[model samples]
Target: MKTVVICAGGPIDELAPLEPYKLSDEVVFIGADKGSVYLLNEGIIPTVAVGDFDSLSSEEFLDLTNRVASVKVASVDKNETDTDLALIHSLDFDPQQVVLVGVTGGRLDHFISVLNSVYRFQKDNPGIQFIVRNKWNEMRLLTPGIIKLTTNPQLPFMSFFAFHENVEEITLTGMKYNVSNETINIGSSRFTSNQLLDEHGSISFSSGICLLIRSSDQ
Candidate 1:
């Protein structure tokens, strides 16, 4: 399966560790705007760079252009953000999984936009594994389906939130706070901070989208 990892123009240092994904040949990396600078600095060359690149200095932009073989430059006045452009570009690669890094911990507006964006992205493109990962959290959006998850000792806390207006008939097994046919409405916090009881767990829902967050205390 092909995987696309997008490094966006957020706090790069806050992204989850990169080592685990570096060795995979199936993974393609793309840099969005200032993210190109971070990727180049880390010695991780991008398959392509996309964005208006307004955040980068002229010299840094030049350096990025010189380093990357393919660069898609968007006009500064474009309506969509750099990360949006990057996500659109990612679909062309026909990736099985798309991991978004450096996409959190920025402006409040941007962070909120990203949250909505991921849900719309998943709804538009079903069957694709879309994830947003940072130092403390790994998040996934599930749409009315059965999701099997393995317990990660590193990330001890697991939480679920209703992404849509009403997520119905929700069920969870093999978890510390298991539920059966429960309904979670949007803006509710009842399902937050649950734990995986054993090596694996399963979550199922009949309707509406669910946001699953796996996180660490540290």
Candidate 2:
């Protein structure tokens, strides 16, 4: 498939354009536990639902089962969280890109755990593109390679950080704070909050991983 969107049961203030995806037959939607109810409330039916679903009430769970054709319920005592299981299920469709929504702005513990899962997924599946986005921010995990991005109207500000030790030969072009072959280490805030200078921007590195963030002020 071209794209798959996974909606988790996290707090979502606003969601980006889903009408287009809803109309198109190529896009797949997977709901993680209570996210199924969230999807239905938004007028989009999930193709598949997967989770332990401890968050849902008995009535809600029955309604969900009745609404969605496919439901994979898990044991509440499982190792992975509902979001993680939902993510793994999404891979069955083998989408070119996976956009994660409603996966942020919840419990701090759940947020951090989901972030770690996303990072691990990126590392394991370097060929596929993964994006985590909400109303205010968009995030991507970058492995060693060059990535070019165009200006985003909603999220104009950009930031880059080393995900591992010694992100070597880092270079940035077409940005406010352009760099050339500089190295940055984990926990360093040297490349934070850089804005785009023009229509396009690029980042490249020889080794290590990076977390690229596109965000806007609320």
Candidate 3:
């Protein structure tokens, strides 16, 4: 599969509209734990399901296994979380893109864990693009390089932050709040809420990791 979309077991209210993804034939859906039931509820069947499944009843687990072609059940005590396991499984296919949805609006601990995991996986698999998406936000981690993006009308607000340390020589062009050769430090809010001045905008950082988030009010 060129694109693998993981429906995680986060709050359903936080998930991006699933109907669009369900209608797309190009995307492969992977359900993580309770996410399997969520997908089924939305009339989308996941090809694979991965999780410890403590969140599901015995009957529900059985139903999911029967419906999904590939089911991977792990120990509840395992070190990796259910979402992380689903992400690992997604990499087995070496997809060009792996998107994570239904993951950003639940527990704070879980969200932070997923965010860090995405950062780690993105660094490890530079060829694969990892994304965290929700009802109103899309996030991606960029290493030291230039990234050109077409402005999304739905998500006009763009924000960049240093991953853990200082990001040096940061540059932003074609943006409403353009900056040049700047430095963004950890815990800095200087780059928040910038919009694209044109149809396209560019971001470049010479050092450190940058986290880019495009968001909307909705």
The per-model lDDT (C-alpha) reads 0.89, 0.87, 0.90
Which candidate number has the best TM-score? Answer: 1
* TM-scores, each model vs. reference: 0.97, 0.95, 0.96
lDDT of 2 at 79: 97
Q: How does residue 49 of candidate 1 score in lDDT?
A: 97
C-alpha lDDT (0 to 100) for residue 77 of candidate 3: 94
Candidate 3 per-residue lDDT, tens place, 1-218, comes to 38889999898888888777776777889999998889988888898999988999899888898888888989999999999998998887778999999898869999999999998899899888999999899999988888898989999999999997789999999999989999999999989999998899799989998999999998
Ranked by TM-score, top first: 1, 3, 2
Candidate 1 off by > 4 Å: none
Model 2, 22-92: lDDT tens digits are 88788899999888888888888899999988989999889889989999999989999888988898889
For each predicted model, how many residue pairs clash, with residues at least 3 apart or on different chains? Answer: 0, 0, 0
Worst 10 residues of 1 by lDDT: 12-21
